[model samples]
Target: MSLGILVAVGGVEFEPSLLRVAEAADIYVVRRCVDVADLLATAASGQAQVAVVSAQLRGLDAEVVAQLADSAVAVVGVTADTLSADEALLRRLGISSVEASDDVSAMAEAIREAVREPVRSQPEFGENGPGEAATSAEEGTPPGRIIAVWGPTGAPGRSVVSLSLSAELARLGAPTLLIDADVYGGSIAPMLGILDESSGLLAAARAANLGALDAAGLAVHARQIAANLQVLTGLPRADRWTEVKAVLFRTLLAVARRAHAFTVIDCGFNLELDEEISYDTAAPRRNGATLEALGSADVVVVVGAADPVGLTRLIRGVNEVMAAVPGMVPHVLVNRARSGLGWSAQEVTQMVVRATGLATVRLLPDDPAACDRALVHGQTLSECAPDAKLTRSFSALAADIAGVPALHARRRSRLGRT
Candidate 1:
């Protein structure tokens, strides 16, 4: 079988040796060029499977390293000094392997290994390309899902719900990743009491800029919050919003999906449109980030307050959510539900149905103390207040989401099985 190859050399001393190695390996040397730019372009175009570069090549700079790292081609640096800074730099740039000696046979073996080995690539959430997505799914060390929790405006309790849901999912034995995709103002790190100075959104943007963000690269940005739960917090500052792009968010979500079984995202509120509104605007918008998260969600939870104003907001938010998200039937969550409002759970459900024509699947009681304690302590409800009504309710919601039987049925099933 003929093998495709490209050799980039700074001097003519190693040209004949490279050709001999190629011939010995029964591989067709496609490009015997000295220009690093041409070599990179050829590699990027997918014409070459393996790139062999000389350490002496002046044009093989950081830009080339960054470009090669992003491309499908496998890069191997052949250097005279294994301990040289150049060799270390190449490896740091994500080169697959580096060789010190000028031995043609050894170089050829390295090339073969690099070519035969799988190349790691980034994940594409939407309709970018099949190859990109497939590569990520197959090559990912720990493939996972990207579950984006989304809702409309008017204080819908999306953040609290998402945080609780992620914690519960992690409790259920699945390795889960929680991401804060609210570009306008992300509260995840603070809510979780994580003093994270780095935001995944910014990291993703930088990755997109260098074209180096793949499943593996994104895994580096994820911070482990629990044994099974990881978090990718939001931007540190709102002014740096320009650094984030919709494509980058999509790519990061895709990567997150591959890294864990469940990747939960706390997305922004506004789903009707994409915008970057000024601070003075009443709507508070950051369209690009929110739209991307909502578009790629596997499951979306529409959260709303239990009161009348909150219900009105939920009603309007649902309409906008349905229009913005194609082919999505959201699960509604009613927050701050209490009998003191003179409305029972059933009655509140009825009222919401009457107003929005959507059923409430989950209801959380108004327990500001419990929530405040958990947020302040950086602990989940299960850890902070396991016996609280809101905690129990949230546990039930998680059980339902994970398809666990209800309390009564669980007891009966256990007795029957026994």
Candidate 2:
């Protein structure tokens, strides 16, 4: 029987050790300088049956994970720490074994076992192949309106805006679906006080990979949050970004529209590229899930904080959004707006207009108490503090979006007619 081939990923620290282990195990070892991009390239080249990667390698992205998944290569992650959330994320991305103790010989044995085992394939969600284009019926089904709430790097209260806006829309009798598309870090489930083990994105990505993600399959995985609201949470693991691609996201939106009346996506900050690229040629680049979501959104809500740094990020983020998503008219929502450090709402709006040449549409007050309470309770603003200022503001925003006329004015008009 032929000895399995092993690829040492990450830096040169383990090269000599790996070679010795390979000799002892009677296996051929190839040392590849592992970076995210390089790792993906190596996997794509099909040169090695097993990959041993360092946990410390930066830019460990989803595309690399997906590449490994598609290649059926057994991956073993080496870390300095014993166990951590980061290690758990690596395992979620399909790395079969994690060696944190740096046991080079044991790592060799693990690699051999990984190569000997049958490559595990993700379960098919439906009949289509993964990453395939949507069919005509699926495309025409009107999945739902994708309302994406995005903002600059600083804390602009994306999760707050997302939850509040979704709740408000639901109150207006619009069946709403809230999706945590913030691939970097999303707090929807935590904020809602729901311990969601499954993220709709994972199921969608898996279906996309198998070309099986259709309208029917999306309904199966989506979790209903309320009578009029559903949510698709972000990936449980950051490395799972591999399964999600631009094509899959587009399909997800399409399917979402067909199932629900409205779909609200809490997209991540940073819209520069599909993924973050590395200064090093060897490191893998970050995937473009955020950018893709922004591009496909019907309405993009640009949020910013009341502080200087927040304002700066907001201005820069606006320009970036415009550049990447051409013809996307954004609605600016200034979060935590208050008279701070001699800056008023009017002054903030003026500065924003001057900097980005865009107009501000709405402002949300700083209601930290209400927000914290709601998040802790895993309840919406409507349930926790419907009378709160931020809640009312979000309700107004929803009314505007839904085109509902003012209550007193409508009543008066009816009286006049009578």
Candidate 3:
């Protein structure tokens, strides 16, 4: 089997000797990408199994690397400039194989090596020795469980569920931090009536990248909503996802988990690893936070609307997430499961189980008034509408997640208009 290489080196750097060396190694130069767009297009055409790209090429960021990987195209970065920063940037962007030598033979060898090390769906956690702890930090505390609340597009109750769940966990006396990780339009600030525009996520990201983030530094970024509930708002604009890198974001998550008893990430809708156009536009995908959050999560709560159309999207969304990371199957949460849409909770539950092959589903009733009150008051369900069935359900979820008996019995109440 001949390995095809898409060469994207500068025209000046593409010396005749480079071609001769690659061809000798049985690496056929099938295409020469002029830019990032052409590189992606060529890779998508299946003409290339490996990309021998110039590291100085424009639009070569982590997202670009990921899109190339999505096409199963291995990337071998060739740069004569062996600066440490450039190499670190490439690795962070998911490029593992890089040739720093100026020789054409080195480029050929790098392409061959990358072909042998293809990307795969990674496990949630990395390989560690038996009996070894996940973190050996000075803080000898078991980190809190990080639960990422995600859903499909079209405003499925992601924020509401995230807020209520975190609030309930805090109310149960577990130290909780509610993170608004929505890379698109984050409504956590307005919903909670916290008028501050300083996104804690960005602060944490900046600190994490600088290696200055710790428990106390993180505290400065959070808003103490209640005794045990803290809020970290998300991006001020939808286009600001570029501020967060996957590796740096992962570091922030570790600090948050260690600092709290429960850290809940209110994630965005998109899960796509979007193909990039250029290095200028090679910002992190809008759902970089969501994917990283999911990958880092101990549990994932996927909320979907319960109407017929909603259920269909939910099924597909769940399947897509499962396909992305087969190791972590999310807990399905069917929001608006009440009868207003002419579907019973039991029927929706059965449909979810059958269609998604998921073993369980949690139902949250359609209570517009209860949800409104919480939003209006900028308070959690437990605080705003304590007796509402929605509040009761959130509390129950919190209990199960915290692994403690609930302050109130788990209410398997009917989906009735209150």
Q: Write the per-residue lDDT of candidate 3 for residues 151-226, one digit (tens) a residue.
A: 9988888999998898788777677889998888888888888887778888887765544556777889888887
Q: What's the residue-level lDDT of 226 in candidate 3?
A: 79
RMSD of 1: 10.2
Q: Once model 3 is optimally superposed onto the true structure by TM-score, how far is the C-alpha of residue 146 displaced, in angstroms? A: 0.8
- What candidate 3 gets wrong by more than 4 Å, as runs, is 1-138, 276-283, 407-418
- Lowest summed lDDT window (length 10), candidate 2: 409-418
TM-score: model 3 vs. ground truth:
0.66
After TM-score superposition, the amount by which residue 172's alpha carbon in candidate 3 deviates from its true location, in angstroms, is: 1.6
Can you give the TM-score per candidate against the true fold?
0.63, 0.63, 0.66
lDDT tens per residue, model 1, 1-418: 5568888877746566556776665667788766887887787777777777866676564346545645767777777666776565454334547785557777778878877787633222322211232234444244564566776666567788887777777777666778887766888888878788888757755764444555656657777777676777888887777666554565566556665677778887755442334332222235666777777776777888888888778878877777778787777888999887888888878776786666555678999999889888877776677678887776676567667754631221110000
Off by over 4 Å in 1: 1-143, 272-285, 406-418
The clash count of every prediction, one per candidate, is 5, 28, 2
Worst 10 residues of 1 by lDDT: 409-418
In model 2, where do residues sit more than 4 Å from their true spots? 1-143, 274-287, 406-418
Candidate 2 residue 8 Cα shift, in angstroms, is: 30
Model 2 TM-score relative to the real fold = 0.63
Candidate 2, 1-418: lDDT as tens digits: 3344545445646555655556654566654555766666766667777776655566554345445656766677665554775464554444557775457678667777877777643321222312222232333444356788888776688888987788777766666778888877768888876677888778877664444565567766776677677777777777666566754575567556656667888887866542235333332334356776777788888888878888888878888888888998788887898765578778877888888777555778888898888878788877778778777788788777667863521221110000
Candidate whose lDDT is highest: 3
The most accurate candidate by TM-score is 3
